[model samples]
Target: MGRNVKSRIESESQKNNLSLIIIILLALQVILSGVVLLRIVNLEKLIGGTEASEPVPVYVEGVSEGDNPALGPEEAPITIIAFSDFQCPYCASANQLIKEIMQEYPNQIRYVHRDFPLKEIHPDAFNAALAARCAGEQGQYWEMHDALFSNQEDLSIEKLNKQAEILNLEMDQFNNCLTTRKYENKILIDLQAGKEYGVNGTPTIFVNGYHVNGADREAIINIIKDVL
Candidate 1:
């Protein structure tokens, strides 16, 4: 009888130990679930914060058209000014969009192109701006402008010269104009004006003095449509 009682006691002890182990496992699972849920919540909050912090569009006062390359009638009802970098891909895209916009709107929109060369990042950009202006002296500004953007991967001095030749510009005059940097002051003025107007990146556009901060196709179209 005593042996049977001892055996029963051992069995009861084993069952108790098994129950404790199961409880511990359940507690660990609960902790892991809580940690995962907390992480998910925090991740959601971070994404929400980021979306909430998107910059609001700026309305700049006195945004100038500048003495720069232009398309469409001078006295067109709408003036669209762009501060662009020739070496910037976004600027190139914006340039194409502007072309389409001009074609669509015809003579109603006056589109002006101003230099805002990001010389630090795009070492060739300042020179490219000069090349365009040099070609402008020969009444082929838009032609050179198109050429530079079309061959954006290569805006080296040699390439600029080749482009001038392709356009049949008097090479001596174009070379002198580019080498002397005749439009340096004008380009600097444009850069300074862009800073004042809160332009921190390339292809910052102004539609009737209202700032559209990027190559935002939809925003640009909407603004122009609304204005018209």
Candidate 2:
């Protein structure tokens, strides 16, 4: 009888142990599944499956269209004033888009590029802006502007000089203008104007006085469509 009782107790204990092991395994599976699910959601957010959220367009008053590098007719129906940094990748992308838009609209839009180099982050940006302006003195502002954006990864003084040569600009004059920092005050004014217009980032564009922040392609197009 004692043997029988011992056997029964051993069986019950074994069963209990098995049940606990099973519960632990289930709990582990649940935790792992939750972690995987969380990772998937985070990945989705990072990859950006949807279109970027657009900011509400506000008519920013006193936004200056100062004597900046511009394209298209001065009296076009839509004037796009862009505050940009030459070293900013987003600005480069936006520059291409703006160029395309210019081609698309042809005579309907005036596109102006204003300097807003983020000096702290992009050490070479201020100088790059100077280089473009120097090239402008030789009647190749847009050419140098395109070159700078194309070679944003390398905007050293040496590279700027090389680009000037490529554009056949008078090297002495271009270098002198850059060395003198001829457009320093003008760039500073643009930076100040950008700050006043609430431009805390690169490629901040104002279309006919409407503020469209960031390199938002759709927002830019939609705004232009509305204006036209």
Best by lDDT: 2
Q: What does the lDDT read for residue 225 in candidate 1?
A: 85
For candidate 1, give the lDDT: 0.90
User: What value of lDDT does candidate 2 attain over all alpha carbons?
Assistant: 0.91
Residues 137-168, model 1: lDDT tens digits: 99999999988888999999999999999999
Model 2 clash number: 0
Alpha-carbon deviation at 89 in model 2, angstroms: 0.4
lDDT of 2 by residue, 1-228 (tens): 999999999999999999999999999999999999999999888767554545688899988799798989988999889999999999999999888988988899999999999999999999999999999998999999999999999999999999999999898899899999998999998998889989998989988898886767787788889877
Q: What do the candidate models score in CA lDDT, each in turn?
A: 0.90, 0.91
